[model samples]
Target: MDLEKPSARRQEPEGCLVVAIRLPVRIVALLVVVPVRMAWDALVVAGRFLNDTVLRPLGRALLWLGRAVFVWPFVGLWRYVLVPLGTGLAWLGNVLLVVPAVWLYRYVLTPSGHACAWLGRGVLAGLAWLYARVLTPIGHALMWVLKGLGAVFAAIGLGVFGALAWLGRYLVVVPAVWVYQWVLAPVGRAVSAVVTGIGVALYWTVRVLFVLPAVGLYRWVLAPVGRVLAVLGREIRDALGHAWRVAGRISLAVGRFLAGLFRWIFVEPVRWVYRTVLTPVGHAVRDAVLRPVADAARSVGRATRQALTAARDSVRQARADVRRMLFGEPRQREAVARREPTGRETRTLGSSTTALTKD
Candidate 1:
């Protein structure tokens, strides 16, 4: 028995129109895109080379120089100069503004605030007493007088309101209700029925005259045309994309050939010269000339340093001798013994020095 591998997906059937359109479009696109792809690859290679060879080093050097020239000086100013200046200004402000303000608040403003608070409390107490003893009684008496007058007015108002309600029912309300029930109700029903009929007829006429034809035109004509246009667009896009990718592969092969040619022609020879010619020449020059000069300079620096040391010693000896002759030998200072033991005379674990543990 033979086993067949399962297919990942099924292929769609293509029409003659799609096959005809795809081939020519892809051919033309390939012709147009090959040069552009090649040029793009060349630009990418040049940008990479320029970045590695020149721009990266230049940017690093500029960054270091900027730190030295601009950034470091500003940092030093902030750390050493501006920081101290700001601290001094802060101290001065504390002395001039903060200290005095604190003093004023503590000595002058605090006492004045206390006095004002006391005065406010006394005034509030007096207002409270006045409201309770005098104003409250007067207000209650006035309210009692107003209540008696309101009761009398309310009785009069009730009588007048009842007469008005009786007159309104006969003169206005009853006539309005009779007119609505007998005249307006039938007229409104007739108008509403006529509007309902007209609305129904207008809806059916619009559906037959406009809506059904629009639906049929869209379904039969526009939708099919739109589908055909969409298929064409999709095919053209796929062809262009396939052509671009094929062109890029061709461009890559060409680029590789050119790069190999350039390396063989230029880079190999320059590398050979640097390795074979320049390296030997530089080593010979360093051994023959630079090494001997460096040795001689080191010898001269050693001799000069020794001579300076001897001269300094001689000057110090002469100063010492003159000072001894002038002062006629200085008296020796008397040594006084300290209570603490010296390093060699340190107490062992078995030994004791305190009064309670003396041995």
Candidate 2:
């Protein structure tokens, strides 16, 4: 038929049918929807962010910044500079006041020493007064507050728990304890003792009536059956072993048989035909077909060689005749033959011999 039809169909597998479909519209749909979906998702994210973000303001941010700028500097100054200056002034005053008193025995109540000692005593008295008046009272007040709170909580807990416990004892706990002691405990013990007695009796009955008989049956009957089964299993195993060995031998024999059959049916005949029939037929065909060609080639070669020899002889004869007419020589061929068999003479003699053999 037409070979081009199938090849054309194969090359343009989707040409017209694919083009007729609205492929461009589908491509446009895909391209347009991707960006629209991305834009919609972006809007959703922005709306979610705005839901929380729209309420925050600059006031809280600036409040912390303002504290850092104003309050932190004052804190640093008081801690690093003001505290050190105050401590140094207090130390100088203490040394000026107390040192003179400590050395009063050496000064012997001199006015300057007395004044320094009095100042030191006054400073000490003032410190004691400040501690007694302010710090002691503050500590007492804190202790009183903590003690009052602890006592109040203890009283409340004791009262509420005492009332609830009394109520529970009256309503639920007393009756439950009474019932357990008088009813459930006695009943449970009696039932448990009875269950134990019955279980003991059942255990003895089964051991005496059923278990002993079953054990005796297994010892006498089942054990002998088991021994017989084991003997049968051994016999079956030996039989299977013999069958397996025989199967292996059969497989080997089948493989040997198949090999011999293939040799006899196919391989030997092929070998015989190639050696005895095809070999001689090939030789005979070569003799029949090629020998004439070789003979014709030899004949053509002989004819060419003879013609050349004759041409040469004629030319030589003409030359000799001309020479005789002029200078005279008739023994060219004889002289050539007597001189020696050169390449030209050898080739001519070989051609003559081949021609003679062919004839």
Candidate 3:
């Protein structure tokens, strides 16, 4: 091998010269893209896994904290304190104020409304019933009279027509019959025989062609069809009634189910909440807040009573002092002696003694 040409170098192993020169570029590319590739695949998976493991729980904890911080206090106040207090207040108001008002309306206005409605209904019913009882019968009687007159006229016309028919039969039919018996009978007997034969043939043809077939059709096909139709109609009517009853029952059941659903959705939940959650919380709040308020009120009331008693005593003392200052002392009559009686008074006493001794 010639050492001057680059491909024919025979001293390649001396300085570790390899056939390929891609190792540096590959090492550099790995050094550059390894982090990016890891970020694209493994980092994303690690991020997702970490999110599920740590961040999601942290988010849930934050949500719970938010709910506890914001929602719980109001819920407590609304359910525990405000609801019971409002219920009590509403009960008090309803008992003291609303019930009487509702009773007044019920007893006063409702009866008046009912009376007015009854009066109006009675008036309307009276009018309608009066018409039905009196006017309708009168109208029916008048109509019957008019129909009777019409029938009488129709009978007269029918009787006139019958008389005319009888008169014409006597005037023409007897003459024609007499002529046929005397003059035309002998001449037309042969033709009458031929006509009689023709009539007999036509009669037989009608019986065979139309009457017998009609009777057979009526007996065999039409009668059976009518009977089947009647049975089908009866079955259809019975099925319709049965279906109506079933539909009614289903509707009743559905109504009951809907009522139960409403109770379950609304009433039962509220009852459970009131029983399990609200009742306990309300009792706790009563112990915490209302008891203290009641104690404070009692203390204040005692203080007020003591103050009022002091004031009342002070007023009585002031009134007694005013009475003593306003009223002066008066002397009694027993403290002074009587003046000596005059001679006239002594004479009067003597006269009284004389009268007493006489008595």
Instruction: Give each model a TM-score.
Output: 0.72, 0.34, 0.28
Candidate 2 residue 313 Cα shift, in angstroms, is: 40
RMSD per candidate (Å) reads 6.1, 43.9, 35.5
* Candidate 1, superposed: residue stretches over 4 Å from native: 1-10, 52-86, 197-209, 287-359
Q: For residue 303, what is the lDDT in candidate 2? A: 100
Kindly list the per-residue Cα lDDT of model 1 for residues 194-279, writing each as its tens digit: 99999999999999999999999999999999987887788667766776777788988898888899999999999999999999
Candidate 3 residue spans exceeding 4 A from truth: 1-233, 256-265, 329-359
* lDDT of candidate model 2 versus the reference: 0.74
Candidate numbers sorted by TM-score from highest down: 1, 2, 3
Q: Could you give candidate 2's per-residue lDDT for residues 1-359 as a string of tens digits?
A: 11111234334343453333334434444454445554555576678777667634455677788889998999999999999999998899779977776678566767777899999999999999999999999999999999999999999999999999999999999899999999999999999999999999999999989999999999999998887666556444544444444444554566578779999999999999999999999999889988888999999999999999999999998987888998755566554445434565454534653456633
Worst 10 residues of 1 by lDDT: 1-10
For model 3, what is the alpha-carbon lDDT of residue 260? 100
By TM-score, the best candidate is: 1
lDDT of each: 0.89, 0.74, 0.77
